[model samples]
Target: MSKAIMDLTELLERVENDRELIRDLLLIFKEEFPRHLQALRDAVDSMDGEKVAAEAHTMKGMLSTLSATSAASAAARLEQLGRNRKVCEFQEAYAAFENISKKLLLQLDTCMAEVGG
Candidate 1:
């Protein structure tokens, strides 16, 4: 199989190898991700740079915590674009973030399954 998206080994280490906590964290992320995504879409659509920055920042932290480096990087890009008020770049940046976010979600699901969440 291809390399996993999130570094589960690293994540487990960070969580002190608590599979149950990992499962709970993944569940919370799954629950919150959609809402966060919607907020990001709204921020992008409205060209609200500050809002986008806030949303992207939140996502970046979450993704980083999960060891999803690629998605976290995508989110960091969005956060930077928003902070720089690059409205013209929002569409492309958001698209990239969205694509990576989808993959991250799938990876998270796989992780959840592996952890028996």
Candidate 2:
């Protein structure tokens, strides 16, 4: 089973009762994740399937912290393709990432709402 995705209050509690961790985490999410996302986007846009796969693999590895199951799986698939030089799977990988990211973000939004921010 997957780890339960955390609500914002739980996240805040874990940071030694300081909600500042939420802000810090949000900053990291915004600053670092978009770069990784853009890397995937650019790699995909350029049709450099290997780069796409590599970027996806990197993303998948890091995204595990969020316990976003589909995203992790998508990244794994992309990594396999990139490592194997099998570029044709890019579409499936992209689709997986897209679906997973949406679901995970929605869950996060709900968590945030529950916690008052």
Candidate 3:
């Protein structure tokens, strides 16, 4: 089988093994992810370094909470690019982050399903 996107074991531990809490968090993430993604896209398109940095930072925190290491790493890269004011690299970095985030969404859906949320 393919590798899991997020570390559910770690995440569950962090949440005190409350599957309901995990499901709730996943639902919230699913609801909010698109808005966050759009904000990041807008920031990137407008070449707003500060906004990009802020958005990426928020996304990194969210992904980290879910134990999505790869997606969090991608967000961190984008955050750094924004911090360094690397507008030229924004598109590439955002694309990579977006790709990982899409997979993360899928994983979250699967997790929610498994938890009966």
What is the full ranking by lDDT, best candidate first?
A: 3, 1, 2
Q: What is the lDDT, from 0 to 100, of the residue 65 in candidate 3?
A: 90
Give per-residue CA lDDT, model 1, range 1-117, as digits (tens).
656778998999998999999998898889999999999999999999999999999999999988889889999999999999999999899999998788777788789888777
* Cα error of candidate 3 at position 102, Å: 0.6
TM-scores for the candidates: 0.94, 0.66, 0.94
Sort order, TM-score high to low: 3, 1, 2
Tens digit per residue, CA lDDT, model 3, 1-117: 657879898998898989998888888888999999999999999999999999999999989998899999999999999999999999999999998888777777778877777
Q: What C-alpha lDDT do the candidate models reach, one value each?
A: 0.91, 0.65, 0.91
Give the per-residue lDDT of model 2 (tens digit) for 82-117.
Answer: 777676767667777766666665566555455455
Error of 2 at 5 (Å): 7.4
Model 1 spans > 4 angstroms off: 1-3
Q: Number of the top candidate by TM-score?
A: 3
In angstroms, what RMSD does candidate 1 have relative to the true structure? 1.2
lDDT of 3: 0.91
Determine which window of 10 residues in candidate 2 has minimal summed lDDT. Answer: 2-11
Cα distance off (Å), candidate 3, residue 49: 0.5
